[model samples]
Target chain A: MNRVRRNKTAIILFIIPTLILFCTIIIVPIFMDVYYSFFKWNGMTAPEFIGADNYIELFSSKAMGFPRTIKNAFILAGLSVFIQLPISLFMAIVLARGVKWEKFFVALFFTPVLISTVVIGQLWLKMYNPQYGIINSFLRLVGLDNLCRTWLGDGRTALPAVFVPILWQYIGYHMLLLYAGVKSIPEELNEAAKIDGANSWQIARLITIPNLKPTLQVCTIFAITGSLKAFDLIYVLTGGGPAHASEVPSTLMVDMIFGRSRYGIGSTIAVFIIFLCFFFAVLIKKVFKTEVD
Target chain B: MHGKIGKGIGNKVIFVFLCIWALVQIFPIYWMFTFSLKDNSEIFGKNMIGLPHVWRWSNYIDALKVGNIGRYFLNSVFVTVATIMITTICALLATYALTRMEWKGQKLANSLIMLGLTVPIHAAILPVFIVLKKFHMTNSYWALIIPYAAFALAMAILICESFIEGVPRELEEAACIDGCGVYGIFVRIIIPMMRPCLSTVAIFTFLQAWNELMFAVTFISDSKFRTLPVGIQTLCGSYTTDWGPIGAALVIATFPTLLIYCFMSEKIQESMAAGAVKG
Candidate 1:
């Protein structure tokens, strides 16, 4: 009995510090966000009591409303699922199939994943620089100078321009994940499929694709959530500028809270972003029936 | 014989396609280095993608001296090291306890940690900022260091637990029978055995700290204390674009990470592959 008590005390000593830190950093902040969502304050002065006004404004088409930001997030989410996933999966399949100098190629592809978002934003910004950028220079050299418009500065292309870098940085990461998934499949399965007269494409489509469902589900969740929470790259690239064309929820929230000093609205946006992420996460989980064993 | 020919052709096509894709992947980094070495005129010259007219090595020198690149580099190094130290130690201890110690609330503890994974750092920015202000930690190393450690705990704990699960408990039992205490056993027997995972944690923590931006922007106010990402932002002006120096500064900022990635690419790839499979 004495030994049991002693062991319990040791466990408490071990666990308490991490538990306290987690509660302070995570749990409290979530509740605070929910609470602050109900009020209206600029964070500089007093918070005015405004019940459900922030949320009601969420659905309304007011300037700095939540609906538009959510719409942008949805669009990004769609791009991630449809565009990013397919291309990254294709790359993963190709890369996994015994390329020469595999290590060098893997390193080259994964380099962007290790770079800072700010640098990537800056690099892409310069790459899209209208006059001196390689993109425009190549266009001119190929006799298509008329087609080269200001990529990031133009409103129509700003969101897509932002999406390109995010896609570029993360496609390698997803590819690596999918490659791991492909490798985990038993080699015997591939050999058996080959014995049954299956070609490479046939084996991959029929065997590899079906078995990669769990990995695909996880990758999809990460991509979707990552797209919705996208901020630093977009913020650095354009600061949601060229007339707020690339305004994600996180950026809009930061602008309101820090730039505009509207705390309550910022909190409302934060709360909304949380809900959106949770909604999508839960929706994906339900669709895929993802469960931890 | 026909089937063999077709298969050979298909492999050749795959090889060519991957080679082109590899070029696309590496082109931007190549452009960054090439542009950094060029003068302003060459940067805007007609042969933009061609060889630089002059290899202006002094641009790097100017970037180091004039652009405060040295200061930003030092700041990033300091912050990254401090964050890695705190996170690695805290995560190692906490994960060891969770996995090996006879804890009463192990399940609840694990569930709470899992909850931390879903709580995105952005959602907590406001309250954390308010808390930091209350403690007068804003603009201090404590501001960045504390938050970096806190936010990283979920991933560290997850990775560490996975590693510790694979460690043989027999070694710990042997160490205990030889009069080693729990702490001693952990230090001597367990930690040395978990070097690969520890290095994996260290590298990941370093990369995360090095690449972080939003928190630094939000929490830091002083120019001297700003890390590379935020410092690079101030290099740009409202109207004018200093293409030469900005590109140079970016090259200086990015070189360390690139070098590390080159050397440690295999290990990083292995760890990431392991993470994906385990997940």
Candidate 2:
């Protein structure tokens, strides 16, 4: 009886603080978000119970502008997979192999990961400055002055321009992860393939790529979730600029909450963002399980 | 054989490609520092990469004055330290329980932590905001500190759990036999043994809190309460097309991370690799 009591006390002492913090920060807020999604409140005023009106407006109201942000997120997700994934994979493979001064090179590639997104966003904002930014200046020097555009100021180029810095920052991180994965593969496998007259490309395709499935799945899920939730870089770069050209759901929700003071609408957006993250997370987990099976 | 020569050439080609890619990686940061040293006119000049005509060291001074950079720095320090303290203690206890204790719902607790790994911050922001408002905690330290701790707990626990599992069960048994209770065993035996993993979690937690912008921007409206990232964003908006002070602020912001990376690159790499593998 005394031993049981002691064990109970230990468990209580261990779990209580964590439970309190998580409940307050995560569990309770999630429930609040669900509740707020059905209301009409501007944060300061009393919330009016509107029974799915917010979500209904979110789906149907072209003026509320959730679809555009969703579209931008989808485009960002696609570009991340199509452009960032391959480049990072190639860089990881090259960096992971027999090379002199590997550490220095790895650090060089990984530098961007250490930078805050706000700084990256601001730096790129200056970089893409139409008047005197380095990009345009270089274009003029190379006699391609006509190619220069107001990258962030233009509605057409805003999304692509903002994506560059995000891609730059994350590619190195992905490369580092993939490099670790690639390095874990036994060197003897490569040696055997080479001895059997397998070409370098064949070895990479058959052995290296197959072996990197787990890493790839991880990277893909991270990319998808990150792209969907991307806020800081976009917030800093253009504030979803040149008229909401690069608005992501998170940024849009932020604008609604802080900018417009529409807390309930913002919560609705937040709920949708959560749903999206959960959806992708579940899909990835399912895919990983199936691969294991 | 031609095959050997071809392979050697291929290796050299790969090396060259990687070096070029490295240049692309470093160029923006290199440009940032150079631009910071230059005056406003030179910053917007046609020759973007040229040496500064006059190195105005006062660009940093001016940026500091204009941005209230000192207050922002203090705010970041306070929030980051509080987050680290809360997260480290809570995560250590939870991780100890999950890994060492024979709890009935250990599986459920573990899954809860794992679920946190995928719960995007945006998902919880609305509810968190409302709850904070209800408690009149908005714009207070609790607003940022609590969420930062919660968000980081999953990562901290994951890394610590892996490290704790590697610790031998015999040590705990011996400590218990010596009349050390569960808490005592954790303090004297587990924590000391888990230093590397603890350091790894600390580094990641610090970086996450330090660089975080979204929540800071959303939660804190007062300028004096704003963290570094939010402060920098405000500076960018006010400075608009003026690249000189903006670049200076960015350089100042990036300096700490650069200094840490310069000295601790290998450790950071190893920790990150370990975390990725376990994750």
Q: How high is the lDDT of residue A167 in model 1?
A: 82
Measured by DockQ, the strongest candidate is 2
TM-score of each: 0.95, 0.96
lDDT (tens digit, per residue) of candidate 1 on B1-279: 339889788878888888898888778888888888887788786446666778888888877777788998999999999888877777787887788876567888888887676667788889888888878888887788777887877777888899888898787777777877766776798778877787777777887899898889988889878899888877754313557778788888899988887777888877766654444
Clashing pairs for model 2 are none
Global local distance difference test of model 2:
0.84
In terms of docking quality, model 2 is medium
lDDT of 2 by residue, A154-252 (tens): 999998899888888899888888888899999999999989988767887999988998898888898999999998888888888778888889888
Q: Scoring each candidate complex against the real one, what DockQ results?
A: 0.57, 0.64
- What's the C-alpha lDDT at position B119 in model 1? 68
| CAPRI class of candidate 1 | medium
Q: How many clashing residue pairs are found in candidate 1?
A: 0
- Please give, for every candidate in the order listed, the TM-score of chain B alone compared with the true chain B: 0.94, 0.95
